[model samples]
Target: MPDSHSLRIVHCFRAPVGGIFRHVRDLIDAQVAAGHKVGIICDASSGGDFEESMLGEMRGKLELGLERIAMQRQIGPGDAVAAIRTYKIIKKSRPDVLHGHGAKGGTYARLFGSLLRASGSRVARFYSPHGGSLHFDLATLQGRFIFCVERLMERMTDRIIFVSKFEQGVYARKVGEPRCGHALIYNGLANREFEPVTPGPDAADFLFIGEMRALKGPDIFIDALTRGSAMSGRALTAVMVGDGIDRNHLIEQAQAGQMSGNIRFLMPMKAREAFRLAKVVVIPSRAEALPYIVLEALAAGRPVIASQIGGIPEILGEASPALVKPEAESLSGGMVTAINDLEGFQQLLPGTQVLRQKFSVENMAMRLEAEYFAALGR
Candidate 1:
């Protein structure tokens, strides 16, 4: 095994946001606590002024070093430039392991890794698709192009880590069955962070916390809520917590549904804020590869009713029959069912901890650390 004392690691990713960003932060914290050298390399411009807050949060969680890479753009030539910059950084620091998250980071790492290997640089390469472009909802020509790129890139990676088994299965099929070096590492929630510490929202209060994009199915969520309200004969209050390209469209839908007073348009919130004000947390995603928001909702002792897509089945397991189809009518019926079976949903609450253990930062880091060593043929 490579000496743990001497192992240096770098986590590369696109701009920081969403679950992958949080995962990297948590992993860095765990690595630091374990006395390993860790650094974060990503475009710092995604979240505006939150860079300091994110850095502070990591520093408070564990002692570690961090580096912010310049993100010129989210795609194309800018990505190529970012790759060169990443390669230069890798060459300078010469990390024992080069791990990547997301599409931009994965492509850059694989390219740099190939160059390093050709130059006889003894550095191990690992990739975690905190749900890359391929895992995204792509029904069009653009999606096909992304799938092709993903397959082409897999040949260069040493091992690919999936945040959910469903993602791994889909990716394995896409890349071909003989593809080796794949691992399933479910994204973990901060159980302590979500434990109910305050009185939740009023009985009518429900919340949706995620990017307000079409893929997240915000419109579908609103449709379900409307249907559920009509069926249950009770007014439902909702707070949509997030922003994206589809924000205006979602707002218009909510207005059309006349859910404005009962449904508030709020800015995206941290985990604590999300849980504190929510009675029920809804993840009506059209496609998801194991969402952290749902896991966090469960950890907070709230009922989560999400679609049966991507890695969600793994999270709900066999006990909770909560997965609904992605369409509005189907999800509407599911929400109604969830509301009618409050007792059953409550029973499912305890089971959240079962999958909760699977997502611990310590476990994820340990597994990754093991992978890094194994990549060196240790």
Candidate 2:
């Protein structure tokens, strides 16, 4: 076997944060631990949000270096220059494998990679959508156009990696199969620091982490909770974590629903802290490709009430038969049942330990290393 020092990898992504960033960060950390040389290329647009901190922590902890491309939210001439800068970085880095994450990274890496591969370079390109534009159902004309573009660009990909089988299936069913070298890798959780803290006496009864976006279902989640009689009055309290453009509207909804006293809108939380304090973790996301919150919640021995969407089912498996649809009534029922069956759910804690083992970053690293070798036909 080649020493880790002999293995070289370049991971590319947009501005930091979210599952994709976490996934790449874990990969870089593990690779470094195993003695592999890892490099990250991204934009330098951190307002120090959760994503920024995750990437920043990697820079601090890992000896690996980063290349930051000047970028912004909107596309313009600057983006083209950023892409060129990325190409230059990849050329100079000369890694054995190039990993592209999310939409911007995947598109740029795929296009530049096609150029490199056409020139008979030894580098192989792998793309992970990380819940990008590719997975969403864009049935409209614009959506169709984007899908076509993705299919065209996919031809340049050496391997298409999906964070969840549900995501992989969505792409494969629409774009094609795994014959083009597809692998389903679940997002890994930092399970080590996720041990349960003593439950807080004054902690919110339910915690909804993640951004306050519609797809994340902040409004829907609040609505569902309101519908449930169990959640009525100040008997049950909730904390809404993370902020977004929709925070005001979500707050408005919470107020209008007469849940103001019962629901507290909290700023984003550190992962371990959130998991520690949460009694019943709510993942009210309308769509998900295996959320880390669900994994983290279960690892902390907290019962999770999540929508039956995407890879969530894959993670929860058959443990919670009350897995509800992403609707007000259904999700409300899930929340109530989770609370009612907390002990039964707690009985499943042993299984969560087992599941945690499977989704740990270390195991993900080993699996990914194997996948990379297989992709290279080593």
Candidate 3:
């Protein structure tokens, strides 16, 4: 394994936005502190100047290197061209371990890692699904095709790292039990993230910070906001912070509900910065593989009302009051209750000591570092 602290690690992923990017950045920071050299290879086509500045900060911390290549989001002939370019970049980096963060990243990591082995290079290949392609169901043609690709990719991978047990279970049910090594590791919060955040004097009543996609249930949030306001008999303001393809649709939904004046849409920023603008964090996701918002909000001592799906229950607890069904009516009811009883809802949040015991970046990095060495047959 070339010693844990001295291993050369390379991470490949499609975009430098959202949770996957955050996960990789935290990992690289910890790896560097532990004396490991790490590099990143991700899509340059997606992020804007803000994301680029974040990546620029990443470059200062990474000891191995960084490569930003033009990559597409969906499958096409262009993927072959992108893979060849990514392979050349990875090969030149001479990494001891190649870790793929999402679907496209996993595909490139395994195929190219295997190809390198064929040419006498030694490198450990690991994939973390992060609810990418596995969200599709086998009842559909695309789902079956992706599942098949996953099954084939297993042969080349040394180990598959599932960020949540819910994700691991879903992959097993959809793609079948893994033929190679696998582990269930929960996503962790940084030490700084654990410090409580005090909302500004002009803080809103609620905050929604994530992609504007329907999968994240922003529509449900908008609908519930209107419904909650009606039920409470007063106007409640909220902020939606993020950008995605679904932004216009969500905006229309908010406007159609006649709550647009009460809702504010801001571009994405650091979660901590977003926290300062709202007293409570709302995670209305229809599905997740242990979202960082849940941990981050809880760590910052904010109450959360999240849908009871995926690894959310695992975080908020099966019987947690914050857990609600992923529907507008249910969400509305939850919202009304939260507004009517803010103090009670605040009391229901998971304790800081409990969160610290369950999700910490130190634990996550230490376990992953050991797993990387183990995958090398050390």
Candidate 4:
């Protein structure tokens, strides 16, 4: 194995947005700073100028380089072509560690890692689910199929990294305990992120700045915003800053509900920038594996209101007022309370000092680097 400090790592993932992208970015930044060779291979179909800007920032940081191509979010005929293309790319990079984030990325990384090994290449294969297909109920056919695939893929995985304990436990229960190696590592942020983001002069009352999808609960956020405003007898202003499969639909719904005056839709930007534009940040995701938005918002000293699903409780405290059920009505209550008494919710947030100790990019990268070396039997 190469020296732990000089390993070649390639990260594979689908979308270059949301928490998964943020998680990879934090790790890549830390790893690159540590003088390790790192690269990224993700989908190029969705992101616009926003993702291009993110890639531009990382150009010099990734010594192993970046390759964005045709990658799909679902399993289909296109996957075979994509996989062949991905295998050829991985072969050229000659990565010491092929670490995959999300489902499709996991499949490609592991399968290609095995194929490389068969051709006498030594590469440590790692997979982080990143709240992928695991959200499916085990009772359904799709859930059962996904779980079966997970079991088969375990054979090719050198180290399975679960970003949160909730994800680890869910994988264990749904797919049965993994027969191979695994570790639970929380998503973390850089030290600078823990510093407060002073709200701008024209900050909105609230911000919902994640992917525009039903699963992430953009619809629920609008509903909660409408309800919260009605409950508090105020026409609160908010911003929805992201684009996705449901962005236009969500915007139309908000407009139809007569919220055009109160709600504004915008494109995705840096989380820090989003923080500065809002008094409070809200993550209404229906499912997650410890979202970075929650950590970013809290670290920036902005009050957060998040759903009580997946590993959110681990960050927001098990009994935190910010943690609410994944329903419009439940979210509305939190919003109403927060909108009516922002200072009260502000005081309940966990301290930045506490977060600094628990979630640091340095710690996360060190642990993951150690895992990579271990996978290579170094």
The residue ranges of model 1 lying beyond 4 angstroms of the native Cα positions read 1-4, 49-52, 59-65, 69-74, 136-145, 201-204, 349-353
Q: Candidates ranked by lDDT, best first?
A: 4, 3, 2, 1
RMSD of 4: 1.4
Candidate 2 per-residue lDDT, tens place, 1-378, comes to 366435688888886655666677778878887777888888787435666656666775433468887765555778878887888888877777888888788887778777777778877788888767655566777667767777888678888888888888777766656446777777776656457655577776578888777878888788887876455432566888887769998888888878887887777767668755657888878887777777877777777788888888888875566477888888876777666677886665446567776688877788788878886777
Segments of candidate 3 deviating more than 4 angstroms: 1-5
Query: On residues 132-183, what C-alpha lDDT tens digit does candidate 4 reach at each position?
Result: 9799899999889999999999999999999888999999999999998999
Clashing residue pairs in candidate 3, if any? none
> Candidate 1 — worst ten consecutive residues by lDDT sum?
59-68
Global lDDT of each candidate: 0.73, 0.75, 0.89, 0.89
Clash count per candidate = 1, 1, 0, 0
Positional deviation of residue 60's Cα in model 4 after best superposition, in angstroms: 1.9
Model 4 lDDT vs. the true structure? 0.89
Q: Show pairs that collide, candidate 1.
A: 188-359
Candidate 4: pairs in clash = none
TM-score pick, better of 1 and 3:
3
RMSD of each: 2.9, 2.7, 1.5, 1.4
Model 3 local distance difference test score: 0.89
Give the lowest summed-lDDT range of ten residues in model 2: 228-237
